[model samples]
Target: MTGGSGGHGGGRGGAVAAVDLGATSGRVMIGRLTDGIVSLEAVARFPNGPVPHADGLHWDFRALFEHIVTGLAEAVAREPQLASIGIDSWAVDYGLLRDGELLAEPFHYRDDRTEAGVDLVHALEPFDELYRRNGLQFLPFNTLYQFAVDAPVAEADTALLIPDLVAYLLTGARVAERTNASTTGLVDVAHASWDTALAERIGIPPTLLPDLVSPGTHLGRLTPELTARVGAPLDVVTVGSHDTASAVVAVPMADPATSAYISCGTWGLVGVELEQPLVTDAAREANFTNEGGVDGRVRFLHNVTGLWLLSETLRAWEDEDGAAIDLPALLDAAAGVDGPVPLFDANDPSLSAPGDMPARIAAVLRSAGAQAPVGRPAFVRAIIESIAQAFADAVHTAARLTGRRLETVHIVGGGSLNRPLCQATADRTGLPVLAGPVEATALGNVLVQGRALGWFGDDATLETLRATVAASVTPVGYEPRNGGTSL
Candidate 1:
C-alpha cells in the first residue's frame, strides 16, 4: 500500500472510491452508500498542479500515480470492502503511449506549443465548418489544435486524455471516456464518438484514439500487481471522465429547462444543459460551447475565466505578507469602497497565462480606459464585480441564443465555497442562486459509478442523485446605486 494504512468497511457499506484530479489538487474520497443517502470521507489529498519546465509545462504523472496508490491504500485500510473506483480530470491534455509505455511526460494544456497551431487548424477546417460539425469552442489548447502543433502523429502509439490515462494506469484498460473525449474538439457532436475523418484531416492517425466508452462502462479489475502491492480489493469503473461533465451530472437541477449552471472553480463554466447542440451562428458568435454531457445532454456553456483571477491575486498578496487579510473582511472592505470600475473583459488572453494577476488586472484596466484600483481590496472587488458582470451578460446571451428561460443558476465546485462570489453572481445575473454540493465533480463521479454497479434502480438517473445531495443558497441582493456597471 502506498500509505500502508488500515481499516474496516467505510464507504456506503457499498464502498466505492473516486480519484478526482483537478488542475490545482487531487483527492481520493471514500464514499458510503447506505439506504438512499451517500456520505463521503477523504482518505487522502495532495497538491496536483502543473510543473514548469524548459520545454513546456508538464504534468507530474509519476508523483500523481504514487499519490493515488497511497490514497487507495488509505481508503482500503479505512473501508476494506471497496466496490469500485472511478476518475475524472480536466479535459484535453493527454498522455502518449507507445510499445506499452508512456512516450513522454504529458504536456500541460497551458503550454505555448498550441499558440502557433490555431491558424493551421482553421486553414485545414474553417472554424465555422468545424463548429457546425463538432460543436466545440475555439480554445487554443483543445486536443485537435494541440496535436496539430506537434511535428507528426506517427510518433505516438496512442493518445489518452487525463482521466483515461489514469484509468489505464489503474486497470490496464485504455478507452476514451466519451464525456471527456468530446471536449477535445474531435468527437462527433451527434453520436459523442471519435471523429476519424477529422483526425485524418488534422494529420493524426485515427488509431491514436482507443475505442470509446460511455460513462459507466466497466473497464476491468485492478491489476493483480496493484492488488498484491496494496493488499486490498480494487475495482475500476468509468464515470463522467471530464471533470466539468461530472460536475454537471451532479448539478441538482429540479427541471433542466429552467436551470442554468455555473460550475464555478478554477474556471467558471456558465450555461444551461440542453437536449441537443445549439449550433446556430448566434451561439457561435456568443462563443458558447455545446460540450457533451451525460445521458445525451449538451452542456451549452461559456468557459469564463473564473476564480483564477482572484486566486492568483491572493497568491500575489500572500507574497507580500498579506496572508492575514481574511476573505470575509476583504469583501466587507471592498463593499465599503465606492464606484467600482466598469466591467473589464474577463477573457483577455493576457489574463489567461499565469503571472502577477494584480499587475495584470491593473494593466487590463489601464488598457480598457478604466483606472486601476486604489488599493488591494479595491482591486479584488473590481475583479469580483467584473466577473459577476460578465456572468450577467453571458446568462442573458445564453437565454437569447438558446430560447431557454433559465429561472435559476446553480453554482457548484470549489469556487462555490466563496460566498461573496456567489452573492455577486446572483445579484449581477438577477436570478435566484443555489450554491453547494461543493463536491459536484466527485459526486458526479460517484453517481455514475453507483449506477454502473446497480446500487440504485435503473430509474436512478443523475438528476435524482443530484436532487438528493443538493443544498441551496439564496441571493444577498446588490443593486447599483449610481448606475448598473457595464464592461
Candidate 2:
C-alpha cells in the first residue's frame, strides 16, 4: 500500500477520516481537500473518561475502540468518497498484548501506581542520562515509569501506544509510530528508534517493542471485517500518532522561526518546533520535552497543566452540587470579575489526579499565602489566569532556551475556543495570539493522509498543507494589553 500519488495540479482531491482521541472526548472528523483548500466536519463525537476499577483508574479502551469504529462508519456514511484513515491520541498510555489479544484494560496515566516506579527509575538510571538519551521530560505518567510499575513484559508479547493500538485494531498492523514513541521515554532521541539498552536496564524485554514507522507510512487496507462493517475499503495511514504531534503539524505558522504554539487541550503543550532536539542541561533543568514531530522535527515544549484545571474544578463543583454547572455562565462571571486573581502552580502533581481539584487548588493557594477564590467564578478566573501565566512562562523559556525571538503564540485545539485563555495568554506574553481550528489534531491527521494520497501533490511540504489550513479557516487573534501585566 502507498499514498495517493497524483500532484495537486492534477486536480486531485479526496476526503480522509481522522480519529482524534482526546482525554475528555473523542471525535471522528472527515477532512476534504480540493483545489488546495481543506474543510473538516465532525461525523461523530463521544465522551471519554477514566473508569474507576477495583485496582485504580483505568481507560475504557473497549468503549473508546467502539466509539472510534462508530465514528469511522459515520464518516463513511457522510462522505462516501472518504479516502484514508488516520488515528491520533494522547501519548504515553498503552495497551499490552498477548498473542495479539489485549491483555487487560490500559491504566489511565493519572493512576497513582507510577509514584513508586518514578522513584525506582531514578534510582536505577539518573534523570540526566534518561533525558540525554530520550530527550523526554520527567512525567510521572510516561510509559517508562508506567511500565516499571505494571511490569507487563513477562506476560505480554507486544506493547502499543494508544493511537497505534487503535490503528492496529483497524488494520491488524502492529507497529510503533515514531511521534508517539518519542513520548514513551524508551526511544533513542538521536536515532529515533527504540532504546533497547534503556528498556533492558529497566527490565523491559527489547523484543516486546514493535518496529518503528514514520508518519504517513501506509499500514494496509482495513481488515475485511472492518471494511465490510464501515462500507468503505479504507487504508490506514500512520500520522503524528500523538495528538499533540498531529496538532503541531497543523499549526498554520507562516513563519515558524518567530512563532510558538500551544496545543491547548487537556494538557497545554507549549513549545516551539525545532529542527533539532534541545537536550542541553538547561532544557533538562527547565523540564522541556523534545517530542518527535512530523518530518523529523522536534516539538520542544513544556507540558503545562491546561484546561483540565478548569474542567476538573467544574467536575468537582458539580459532584458536590449534584448538578451540571454551566461553563459559559461561569466563564462569563469569571470575566466580569475586576481585580487580580490569585495564582498557583498549575503543574502541581497533587492536582493531577481525578478528584477534588477545586479543593486541592484552594489548598495550594492557601499554602502560597494567597487567598483562595471566594466562589466558582473566582476559581475559574484563577485557573484561566494560572494557565495563561504558565503559557507565557513556557513561551518565554522556549525562546530563551532556543535563542529565538517569538512574535506570536498560536493556540490550537479545544482551548483555542477559550477567549479568556487566549486573551490572557496574549496579555501575559505581550505577543499576539492566534486561536482557532479547534480540530487541529484532526486537520493534521487528515492533511498527512491527504498528502500521502497525493491530495497536495508530489512537491507538497508541511508548509503547503498549513497554507491550505490558513485558507480554509479564519483564526481569531489577541494582542497584548496593559503593557503586559506581571504574572
Candidate 3:
C-alpha cells in the first residue's frame, strides 16, 4: 500500500469495504473519510454460528464465503469507487489448505474437541513456559492447542486464521496478519515473529504458517473471477485481521496510557495499551495477554466472556416459549430491581460451551450459595451485574498488574450500548465509562484501509486515527453514582 491516487480508486479519498465477522453474526460496511469525519454505511448482514458436524462443531466456510462474495458485489454495486476490502474475525480458529484447496470447514472455538489438545500441549511444554514465549493468556482454543489435535495440519501446506483465510479466497494471497497471529500461541510476543521451534515441538510444521504482514500491507488485487463478480478490481489490504484488534484501533480514548478499554462483545477484553510486551511473571499469573497491535503497539488485555451469557440465556428462553424476547424492555425492567441481586461467576469454564446457559448459571449460583433470581427480569439483572463485576475485577487487576492508575475506562462495541451494563461497570470500577462507536471493529477496518489509500495524508499515526474516530462519532458517558465507585 503506497501513497498514490492511481488505479481503480484513482483518488486519495474513497470508500473501503470492511468485512467484520463475529461468533454469532457477520456484516459488511462501506466506510469513507471526509474532512476528518469517518462515516460507515452497513451494506449487508448475515447470520453466523456453529454448524454441527459428525465429529464436532465447525464453521460453514463455503456458506460464509458465498455471503462475503455476495456482500462484496453488493458493496461494489452501491459504491463503484470502492478502493479495497479489509476483513476481521475472532482469532484462533483457522482453515487448513492443501495446494490452495480447503481441507475442511474450520472447527468452532467453543467446540468441546480441544480438551485432549490442552493436555497434549501442556505435556510437551508447560503453560508458564508457553506464556513466557507467546505472552498469551491460557485459552483452551488458542491456535496451537487446536493444532495439537487437528489432523488436517499433517496434510495441509498452509493454515490461515479466519480473516486471512477469507482474504486468501478473495485475493489468492497467503499471509498471516500479525495482530491476529499474536493470539495463536506460536508467535514470539517480544519479537513479533513466529516461534517455529516451539511450533514444531508442539506438532505444527512451520511450513503450515505463512509469512506475516503488518496491518496496511497490500495483499493483492481481487481474483479475476472475483473481479468479474464484483464489477470492479479492488485491492485487499490487511487491517488488524482480528476483530478485537480492529475494535481497539477505533477506541476513541482521550489518552490510551491512562485509560483502560473494554472491547465488549462476545468477550470483554479489558486492559490498557503498551509500547512493549509485558511478559512478567505477575502478568502471566494474572493471565494477561500482550497481543500485537497496529503501528507496533501492545494490546495488553484479559478476555472475560461477554454478551454470550445474556444472548444464550435469551436464546434458551426463546426456544422454550417459541417467541422473541424484547431485550430493551427486559433490560429496562431489570434496572428497576431495587435490592442486591444474586451474582454468579461469568468466567466459569463450565458456562463456556453452547447449551442450556440459564441452567448452568443457576447451578453456578447455587454452588456459590446464592439462590437464582425469581423471574426473567431479575435473572437478566443478575447476568448483567455479574458481567459488570467481572469487568471491574479485570480492570482493577489490569491497573495493579500494569502499575497504571487507569483513571478512565472506554467501552466500545455492542456492550457499550448496554446502558445497564455500562452504569454497573462505572459504579463497580469507580471509573467513568465512555461508550459508543458500536461498530468500532468495522470503523477501524475502514480507518486502516483509508490510511493505506492516503486518505488521512502522510504522517498519520494511531493517534491521528483516534482523533478522526472521536470527531466522527461521539461517546456516551456514565459516571459512578454509588459509594462503591471508590478505587
Candidate 4:
C-alpha cells in the first residue's frame, strides 16, 4: 500500500506477497498471518521516482516492472509456497495501450499540462455537478484533467491505472480496479464504475477504459513466460490496488466513534472510514473526497500537503550544502526551538512542484510579514508547525463536514514517526493522537489479502493483527504555558 517508499503487509505465514510501488521507492513484502498476527518480511526493495523529461515528468514503467518481477522472485525464494500476489501503487496516473502495447511512457500526475484543464472542464459541466457525479476533490492533476488535456483519447486501445497496469503485466489480465479508478475523475461515484458519458465528454474513447473490477478479485496467474523467467508462480490477485484504499483497510478500526487516520506520506490523507460515501452538499463545498475502501466502505478524507513539503525543503537544503543533515537529530533540535514566527499555508501551489523549497518557504514567510528562520532547527520548526496546523485544519474540517466528532486521531505512515508533528497535531486538534503502525499501508494491504485469501474470516481478525503489531504512542498534551492558547 505504500506508494511512497515501502511495500507492506501479508499475514504472518499463510503465504502472500504485496508489490507496493510508490513515488520514491518500491518493495516486495512477503506476508503471513498465524495465530491472528500478520508479519511482513521484505524480500526485495529498490529506489524509484519520476524521470524528468522535456515534456514533463514520466514514470520509468519498464524499470519499475523489472523491479517488481525481481521482488516477486525474491519473495518466492524467501517463501517457496506463495499463495497469491497483490499490487498497489499511488493513484491517478495511468498508462495507455494501442494494439495492446503501451503507446508512450505513462505521464506523471505532477505534469504541468493539467494546469488549466480543471477550470476548462468545469466550464463545460460546472464544478458542483462534476463533484456530485464523481465525489472527487478538485486537484488539477486528477486523471480527468490529464485526460482532458490529452484529448482524442480514442486512439488508445486501453487505459490502465498504475497498479492495474502492473497486475496486467504479471497476469496478462486487464481490469480497472474500482478502488484506484475511483480516484480518477472519470469514475461515477454512485455507480462505482467508469463514467462512459464523462469519457465521451472529455473526448476519450470509451473503449480506452477497461472493465471495472471490485477489490479482492483474482486477476489471473502471472504469465507463463514471466513465471518461467522469474522462477516463481505468476498468479496475482487484485487487492485494494490503490495505496490509500489499502492503507485505510489496515487502519485499526477500534471504535467507529473515536478513530480517525492520517495516512501520512507523499500526501497526508486524513479522514475517517464510513460504511457509505457522504455525498452531502457540505462535503462537496468543503472539497472533501469520499474514496472507496476495501469491502464496500468509503474513505471520507482530505488530501493535505504532507511531508512532501518538509522533505522537499530538506532536499533543497542538502542540494545547496555538500552534506546531508541528520534528520532525526535535526527534528529533535527543531522541537526545542522557539519563536517559529508564523506558519505558511502548505497548500500553496508554489510548494506543489519540484523546487528550491527552502528559498520558496522563506520568500513566502517574508511576504506574509513573518520572520523566516535562519538556522536548520528553526527551518525544521516552521515546516513541522505548518504540517501540524494543516492537520488541525483538516481534522476540524473533516469533523464539521462529516458531522462526526472524531475522538482520536491516528497518525500512520512515516510522518507519524515525527514526535514533534504528532504532539503539535494533538495540541492543535485537542484530541488524543495515537501514533504507530508506521507501515499502515502495507499492513492494510496485507490484511485485505488475508481476508480475501481466507486467512481470517472477519474484522475481528484484523483487530487481532493490529493488536499484535501496532504500537501506540500517547500524545504529550501541549498546554498554554503562556496562557494564550493550548496549541
Candidate 5:
C-alpha cells in the first residue's frame, strides 16, 4: 500500500479507447476486456487548463480538439482492433454553436463571470425551486447559470457540453450525453429530460438544447472527413460524459448501497450511488447534488473543493522556487509532522481562484484565528489535513443524508495515490478507506464501450462492470486510527 505501479499497460482483446479529459489534463487509453481482466494501455496524454482570453478565463477548445483527435488517431494506430471510443470530461462548462460552428471558446467554470448569471437566474426562479426542478447543487458556474449572462448563447443555435461537443465535432452528431447534461441545471431531476420551460423562463432558447442520449448508446461513427484525419472510422459510444459520473462508474464497490465514493481529483465528488435521486430538503440544504448516473441510477453526492487546493498551492510554491517541488518527497516529509497542523476551511470561496494560493490560504487561516504555517512541510501538512477534513465532513454528511451505515469510503482518481491524505481521511471519518484504480474515468469509459460492443453482453449493469474492475485492480486499504478523527 505504501507504493504503487502501472499508469498504462500493454494488452489487446476486445479493445476500445477512452478519451478521458480532466480540468487540468487529458489522456487517451486503450482498454481490453478479456479473461475477466479489464486492462488499460495509455496512448497519449496532453496538458489542459484555463487559457486567459480577452473576455475572461476560457478553455482552449481549439487546442484541446486538436490534441484529442491526435490522441485518438495515435490510439487507433496502436490498437487496430479498437472497437469504439467514448469521451468524458469535467461537467458544467460548454460551447455554443451556430449553424454547426462554435460561436466562442467555452468559458472555464472557475472564471469569476457567473455572479451576474446567478443573480439573473435566481431572479427568475429562486435556487430552492430550481433545485426542486433540477436537483443540481448551487454551483455558480452550472451551465444554466452561465447561459443566463452569456450573450453569445443568444445567437447560437446549439449548445454542447464538453464531451458532447467533442463527440459532435468528430461524428457530426448533435446529441447531449445525459450524464453531463444533468449538470447543466436545465434537465429535470424527476424526468431526466431537458427543462425547456425552465430555459424559456430564464430567457435561454430551448432550441439550443439537443437530443439527449444515454451511456452505452452508439452516437455514430466518425464522419468520413474526420475518418481521413483520425485514421479510422470507429464508432463513438456514449459513456457517462461527465468525468465524475464515469469515475463513479468504476468505483469498484461490490455493494454501492453500503459504500460512499470520493471521486477525488480537481474536486472531491463525495457521495453514494443510488437507485434513485435523493432530493430531500436535508439533502438540498447540505448542498448535495443528485446527478445522473449510468443505467438511470443517481449520483447523490456533494462537491467539496478537492485536490485543486494542493495543486494550486504547489504551483505557487513552484513559482517562488523557480522549480517543481518533489511532490512525493514533500508529502513524505509532511506525513512525519509531529502533531495536528493548523487547518482552514478547504471550501472557502476566496481560495477558489488561481494565483498566490499559499498567500490566500494563509490569509484565510489568519482571518479564522489560526496561526499561519511557518514552513513548507507544515504548510503542506496543513493543506492535506484541511482537505482530508473536508472530505471526511462530506462523507459523514452524505451518510446522514442518505441514512446509510456507510461501511467503506472508496477514493478513486489522482488523489487516491496520496497515501497520507487517504490515511487522514480514514482517520477522520473513522472508516476504512479503499483507494486505487487511479484511471477510473478511463476505465469506466472503456467499460461502457466494451459493453456496447457486447464484451459483457447487453445486460451488464454498472455493478457488473464494477465487479470486473474489482477483479482487475487491488485497492490499497487504510484502517481507522486509534484516536478517531485525529491526524
Candidate 6:
C-alpha cells in the first residue's frame, strides 16, 4: 500500500509543511512526496531556548509562535500548494488557556520548581503504583509533578501540549493529540485516555484537558487569518506530536523484530518498539518509559541525559573563554586521544538543570573518587564516553525487560551526524549502528500528515511508511570493534 493523491492540486506528489520544535532549536520543513519517495527541505530554522525570569525558566511561547508563523509563510512561498501542516515538539510542557486566551508562558521541564511536587506525588501515589498505572518512567518533570508543584490557574479552561497549542494558535482548534499526551503521566496506559481520577488526586481538573485525538486526525483548516497571512489554505493535522514519537515513526528499521533506536538529540530516547506497554516491576526498576508511538505502538524507552552534557559543557567553556569552541575540531582531538577517563551517571539529578556543567561533571567525578579530565578535549571524550555507556545500559535494559534480542541500533536525529558518538555507541553496545535521516522528526510529522490526507492509501502500514523513508534516505553504518558488550 502507498499514499495516493487526496488534497491540493499537486496530485500524489504534493508537499506538506512540518513544524518541528526542539529544546535548543526549531525548524519548519517542506516535505515533498513524489510517488512513494519523500524528500525534505528546511524552509526556516531558528534557535529556541528557555527565558529566565524572576520566578523561574519558561518558554517564550509568543516568540516561538511568531517563528512558526514565519516558517509557515516561508513554506507557503516555496510550495504554494502545500497539502497540510503538522507540528511536533518535546513533550510534558504545555500552555494553559482561559476563555481562549493563553494564561502564561509554559514552564520549561528542567525548572527546579518540580522538586517539591515530585516528593508530594510519590507520597500520594507510590512510585510503583503510579508506574503500574501510567507505565511511564519516573521523570521528575512529568506534567503530573509539574501540576502538583503549581497547578494551572483556576480560571484556565483548557490545557494543550506544546504541539497542540501551536496547532490551536494556527487553526483555532483545541484537541489533545494522544502521542504527546501520553507523556503527561496522567493518562491511562491501558485505555489510552486521560486518567481523570489520577488528575483529580493530583489537583488538576479534568475539564482542563481537551478531548484526546489520535495521530493523523485532521485538526481543521488553518484559521482564515493564518491562511491569508501565509497565502495558503492548509489543514492542520496531528502527527506524533511528541518529537520523539515522530522520530520513532520515521526510524527506518529494516527488521522491526530485532531493532532498537536512540532518537538522539538534546536528550537520547533509547528503547525498542513494543505492541503493548511494558508495565512490569523490572521495567519500573530500570526507569524505562512507555510513551505512545504512531499507530498505537508503545515507545518503550529510557531517557538518557544525552548531548546536553556535551552541549552544556561547551556552553560553559564559551561563557568562560568569551569565544565559541570549534566542535568538529574538539571532537577530532577527543577521538585521537586514547586513555582512561572517568564515567559519571549521565542521569544524575545534579546535572539536570543548566549551569556550570563542566564543573558539575568534575564534581560528580570527584565524588565518585575518580580523577577529572584536565583539558577540554579530555572532558569532551569523557562526556561522549559517558553518554555511550548510558546508551549501552539502556539498550541492555530494554532487551532484558522486553525479552527481545537486539541486532541493530539506529541512531536518528542530530546525533546521527556525529561520527564519534555513533562509533562510540557501536563499540560500547557491540552492535552495528545505523545512523541517518537527521530530520526523522520532521519526516515522521510529514509522513503522518501524508497518510492522513490519503497521500498514503488507507491500507498503508507503519512498515510501508518506513519503507518510503528507507528508500529516500541512505544511512551510515558503524561496525562494533569489541567482541563483547560493554554492559
- The candidate that wins on lDDT is 3
Q: How far is candidate 3 from the true structure (C-alpha RMSD, Å)?
A: 1.7
TM-score for each candidate, following the candidate numbering: 0.92, 0.97, 0.98, 0.92, 0.96, 0.97
> Candidate 5 lDDT, tens digit per residue, 121-172?
9998999999999998888989988998899987999999999999999888
Per-model RMSD to reference? 4.7, 2.0, 1.7, 4.3, 5.1, 2.3
Q: Give the Cα lDDT of each candidate.
A: 0.80, 0.89, 0.91, 0.78, 0.89, 0.89
Q: Give lDDT tens digits, candidate 1, residues 99-203.
A: 768877888888888987888889899999889878987889999998997754578888899889988887888889888899988998887888899889978
* Cα lDDT over the full model 1: 0.80
Best candidate according to TM-score: 3
Q: Which of the predicted structures, 3 or 5, would earn the higher TM-score when compared with the native?
A: 3
For model 3, the superposed segments whose C-alpha errors exceed 4 Å read: 1-12, 483-487
Residue range 103-160, candidate 4, lDDT tens digits = 7789888878888777678777887888988998778898888888764355788889
**How many residue pairs collide in each prediction?**
6, 2, 0, 13, 0, 4
Off by over 4 Å in 6: 1-11, 484-487
**Candidate 1 vs. true structure, TM-score:** 0.92
Quick one: RMSD of model 5? Answer: 5.1
True-structure lDDT of candidate 3: 0.91
Candidate 6 has which clashing residue pairs, if any? 2-457, 3-455, 3-456, 4-455
Clashes, model 2? 2
5 versus 6: better TM-score goes to: 6
Pitting candidate 4 against candidate 5, the one with the higher TM-score is 5
The Cα error of candidate 3 at residue 81, in Å, is 0.8
